[model samples]
Target: MARGLGATVRRFPAGDLAALEAMLTEAPPGVSKMICMDGVNSMTGNTPNLVAFAALAREHGALLYVDDAHGFGVIGERSATEASPYGHRGNSIVAHAGETYDGIVLVGGFSKAYSSLLAFLAVPTWLKDHLKVAAAPYLFSGPSPIASLATVLSGFDVNAARGDAIRADLHAKTAKVLATTTALRLATPNTSGLPIIELPLANPDDIDGVGHFLFDAGIYVTLAAYPLVPRSEVGFRVQITAANGDDEIDELCTTLRALAERFELQRHAELPAQGRRIGSATPDAEVRLSA
Candidate 1:
């Protein structure tokens, strides 16, 4: 969108808050800035520290734009007596990190958690009023399908009824997969323990063979091949959800063990801790894009 608008974008390396601060400090006068980042990264399944980012945005007079596509209905506000580490209510990472929309613009969709075809933007009232006229999607896109709308409405009901239980189930299933990674001594960039887990291959050239192996094992995964990702980071991603069965998880773990045995996998101890810093930009690593 920034490219479409012909805006000059400056990207900072992921989790480099000091570098971001330097950029903000060195910006030319009269140039509007928007600090865009992810809420919960889709690849590594880690979350940025919204509190710190929000503070920086507020200080710099920039709008903090967050894409929480994978976080909505999964993680939310923390509480003393919450049901699980995922927190209470599926509001999104904005609430999960105990931040507000003061200098923040959160955009997320129902596609991941609710499996619906709707998206949303949580902006200030002034921006909301302006966007009603200036937003391209609002002015140009056709109305959403009736079926999708119905699903969203029903989803709200389901969420209100037993969302916590569903999240708990998801957490348990994800924990099982994480345990498999631990036991196999395979290194993954997943620290938040969210459903999405990426296992980088020791040999990036083996991605095709790995995909084939998983496919033949009756398992499907998102392959991050070279060009799409750097050679060193090429691998596959696994997502565990409440809908997945125990038998399926067992098969996945067994297949992962076999995969480790057949093909060399990156050991957790050998690799340094991945993305330990707060407010990292990339979902997977310290990447800088010019868009």
Candidate 2:
């Protein structure tokens, strides 16, 4: 879209905030910048620093846009009295990080946690008005199916009633997997412990065999193939939910341990608790931005 509009675009690696800061600081005055990024990464289950991102965007007079697809209905506002580390309310990463939506536009969907085909955008009134009229999808697409809408409504009720308990259950199940990985000396890019665990293979060529093995073991996982992801990140992803049975989780852990023993798993030192982060903006005519 930026290219279509003839704007200068610069791509940056995930969690490279320093680079974005330099770009924004060095840009000429009067450039209208919009910073865009993910709240919770789907691959790593890691979250960027939204508080810093929002502050940086506000300081630089840029619009901050966040796609929190993996975060919505999962993580939310943090508090001392919260039930678990996943936080409360399932309002998305913005709330989880204790950040305001003043200069931020948060987009998320119900497809993951809510299991519905619905999406939302939390934006300011001005942008809301602008998008309602200018956004092509809103103009051209039909309304969401009634079934989907109904699920969302009932999902909200269920969330309000026992959402924290559900999140706690989810967190525990995910912890089981993380603990198993740690104990087996297996490397995973899942520092957040937010359910999406990517266990990369020591040998990328073993992906097909690993997929077959897991399928035969009655465990389904998302396979990250070579062309889809770099060879280094080629592996499988495991997702845990509240509805998952304890026995199912046990079977998954057992299968994972078997897989680790059968195939040489990647070996790496335990990563620190924190994850990387970045956010920025684009100017008007120049419109420089990064992913």
Candidate 3:
């Protein structure tokens, strides 16, 4: 979007608050100091501090645009401190923070947790009319199918009704995968936020090798490298869903364990105590590749 819109882009290495603050300070005068960020980072699986981001963005006279794609229906709940019990879902970013800031613009898709195809953007009522006319897709694209609309609505109902249950089950599976392999270090934030698991391999070829091996074992995982992530970071990502049961979880764990044991997977040297970045690394360690 920025490219087509002819906007100059400035990027930070990570979403650390300090990094963001520096970027904000360096932004040129008279330019809209808009900060676009993922509520739950796709690669890190860590939820950003929405309240703090909102506060800082306000200080800089900027709009904070949040992509809550991973958070929409899977995380968040009514805060115990809040008085009202009803009408607050997606407390992770939008529903809660939007109340405090008119500058917050939230956009998310139904694909991740809601299991649908379309997406939506929630902004202050004042901007809605402007965006409807300004945003090209909303103006040009054909209308969404009624069936897809119905599916998402029904899915939203279920998501709200049983989201906590689904989140609990997903976390359990993630824990199982983490515990099953001692040699493997998770690349995502160590939290119950999302069910994404990333394994950093020492060799780029090992990523392809592991992905193919998992496919052959009746399991599927994503292999990412280079542009998807830093070139130094090459590995596969696992998206755990509540749809899988004990048998499936066990099979996945067992297969991952086999890969670690059979190929002698090396734990990356630069892992933090929590294993967040697992550090950008080239998987250079030798492993068994022969069939």
Query: Which 10 residues in a row give candidate 3 its minimum summed lDDT?
Result: 282-291
Candidate 2, residues 74-168, lDDT tens digits: the string is 99887778777888989998887777789899999999999999999999999999999989889999999999999999999999999999998
lDDT of each: 0.83, 0.82, 0.65
Candidate 3 residue lDDT tens string, 1-291? 886688878876545668889888988887877788887667656556677778888888888889989877655544554222211354455553333646888888888877778888888786789878887888998998898799998987875686556666666676677665433553343333346766666666666677778899988887886677665567777788889988999998888877776554446344333232111121111111111
Which residue pairs overlap in candidate 2's backbone?
31-283, 32-282, 32-283, 32-284, 33-282, 33-283, 34-281, 34-282, 35-280, 76-96
Clashing pairs in 3: 202-283, 202-284, 203-283
Off by over 4 Å in 1: 270-291
Q: Sort every candidate by lDDT, greatest first.
A: 1, 2, 3
Name the candidate, 1 or 2, with the larger lDDT value.
1
How many clashing pairs does model 3 include? 3
Prediction 2 global C-alpha lDDT: 0.82
Candidate 3 accuracy as TM-score = 0.81
